[model samples]
Target: MKLRNWLTLVFAAALLAGCGSPGPPVDPAPVGDVQRPTPAGTDMSGQVDNSGPAAPECNPRASLRPDDTIRPGSTMDDIVKRGYLIAGVDQSTNLWGFRDPHTGELQGFDIDVATEIAKDLFDTDDPPIRFRAINSGQREEVLKNGEVDIVVRTYSITCERMQEVAFSTVYFEAAQRVLVREKSGIQGIADLGGKRVCAAENSTSVDNLTEADPQPAPVQAANWTDCHVLLQQGQVDAVSTDNTILAGMAAEDPSTRVVGPPLSEELYGVGIPQQNEDMVRFVNASLEGVRQDVWRARYAHWGLGEVLGNMSPPRPVYR
Candidate 1:
């Protein structure tokens, strides 16, 4: 046989030898291992300096007195003319300011508090308002940048923070505490000596941890929920923050519980731009009115009494 014919016959035999009844196609093995994603700005390793000159001593709870007079061209006047109040809020902090999974509507004590302000501003039960969701670290930045007219998130008042933005009278007081798995053998902050604990970056919780006597390694996440994720994934041994936040986390995961004595007293206030004194006073006045009735009702509505006990709103103090 010719060489060409011989080669062709060999190829035909090879094809015939390989042919068989075909079955369902099989997927190839995955190329790489899947990794659960952490939220943006998560920092597994970061250091906080606790040695800074003790932030200029001032009573963080004291703020300007309530003023209902909205002068022409002032911040409140502008907001009134705009027809809708823009508020910065959180959507993942559970009872404080979280989204309702069933209705897809934002509902929480903080949301209600912000809504009360809007209602009074427009003089209606259903006021024109818009809620802008933001992370814990973005509270001051949003106010300073004028991205939001007011930040009603769990924004703690601090002397350092006061320099950049203004605050309304204290609205809620939360205590810093620790959250750990029920059976993690970690009973309190004393037990967290060398363990990794998670808190959102730029939060006062990190400072508390770093300033502790036997400091546990502090890991920073982008949000409080991200800290919860770290706790669940075993990336961190505990999550520490405000009691209100820790209570929400415990409610979300029954396997965990808040432990330890309070690390610090955190006084939350409405964040406003330094230039917007009129807005601050207006919000203070709104808060003053809310404390009379709406605050207590909303606190009970969010079921906070079960976790935080029946509590009254913090009284406003003027400087």
Candidate 2:
């Protein structure tokens, strides 16, 4: 009888405890897709029309004085002291920054650029290069938070982005184009009207698609590789982005080919956090040194000729 009374009291105590009220239901994390921020007053309408944002000249703010470059004892002193260069780069953007599937080693045009910068900073490109693999959405946050010293992953220089980070003088120019399955019958951006088009979220490529004449249904992915998957699965009709990127995707899948005229001009620059103007100048000087035959050899080495196609190197325009 005492044991029964004790059990009844324990049950009553359990009932009084806070396990009775279930909290609000929790949602599962989003897979493959994320909510990307858009500018205030971003047109939600997927309508394509002639009336769209005017295309800028794609010129960045003037670069720092090339003659009087950033000194080693300045901002770069800390990076050297750290013993390794911390670079934020894309690990999936084909010729620009993808890792080799067989060797599992990072290799790309941007990787080469980062190597050159490391060589200049540390006196040897073979030094420890700690790569932080990040996607388009993470670029600004990573730079702003000091998560990386520099970003060299096919990053474009933009007036808006300048507010967050400083960029080296333009080193490469890429033009936006469309990629479609060879048999899809889609010729270009104009042909994408009413079809599903995939572009990386927070990329200017989406904006280009939205401004097309007969709008496509936009599908946003976390990475360009995700868009490639969607295209192969027939979930998206076409993938549109810089031709430099499209070329890399095309190389991966023989069934897909880059089609269409240029949609936008992408000026590639090395991204440095705003706090490190010295690093910016240091990077710019490295670019100037590699601007000639050196960059050409890299483009040829990566088979970027299909996209770059005799493109001249961009000169410095200092602010």
Candidate 3:
């Protein structure tokens, strides 16, 4: 079989394997999960939106019900019963969650989010988290089959995805954007006429860029890093992806930079299996903690201020 065909087959088999067994149902209860306030107040009114549509206000409290069977304090019990907090993530998306060459350990923004949840459950700030490297298409399936307890792979919360998985409140916000060589003179998506643009296969970035006005040829790469390699080699004029991922790429390559404004805005939510309300609530609370206590610190440590601007301390937006 061809290489692309082989990869497709492997991904299909992984999804099939992930659908065999449903994990234990979440407990229903209104236990007091800790709620930490965001350091900076949320003001979406002033937030810019260059992407497809503004995010609808989702009710975080709706995911938490007072009559829920599982009480708040049961988060640890659930994980202990399950043995490990199996987190599905992308090991190739740098700055979010990638395997470090020196340590052979997964590290990034998403990894930190998972670590926070593990800490909340184990009462240790640095609890060990087992990661299952997953592709964009495999995230929901991994959660469905109990292959992973949570997915923190820069997943965007969409109505369609909600049908298959429960998502926590918006922990991090990102936008679809373009990245180009500093000397390419490509200002934004509008400048891509007749230019070759690359995006990850099976990603929303491909769909969005392909449907743009000028309709530049959309090349598919196995991952964003692969797409960046193509761009560096002059195989493509520009590469497009989430702003966070693109920023990380730019950090690695001084010759590259993110161009123009964002094309679309998206919210990053932690993925839990659908109907796992207890787990959803618990994870939501954990996200609130990250947004308040650790988000800004990590962003600065990761040098994200250049791309994200003064939004280092994320403001909470609960509806």
Top model number, TM-score: 1
Please tell me which model should have the higher TM-score, number 1 or number 3.
1
Best by lDDT: 1
Tens-place lDDT digits, model 2, residues 1-319: 6999999999999888857778888999879865455333333344434354544454474667554243557777878788889999999988889889999988899988988888878876477788989988798889999999999888877876776788888888888999999998888888888888888777788877877888888777778888888788776799888888899999889999998889888888889889887788788778888886488888788888865577667777776
Clashing pairs in 2: 62-317, 62-318, 62-319, 63-317, 63-318
Per-candidate TM-score against the hidden true structure: 0.88, 0.80, 0.75
Q: What local distance difference test score does each model get?
A: 0.88, 0.81, 0.76
Error of 2 at 192 (Å): 1.3
Identify the superior model by lDDT, candidate 2 or candidate 3: 2
lDDT of 1 by residue, 1-319 (tens): 9999999999999899789657789999888976777667888774665666667889999999899887889888899999999999999998988899999899888898899989878889999989999988898888888899899888999998998999999999899999999999987889888779999888899988987768898989889999998889888899999998888888889999888888999999989999989888899999989899788888787777777787899888998
Among residues 3 or more apart in sequence or in different chains, the pairs in candidate 1 whose N, CA or C atoms overlap within 3 Å are none
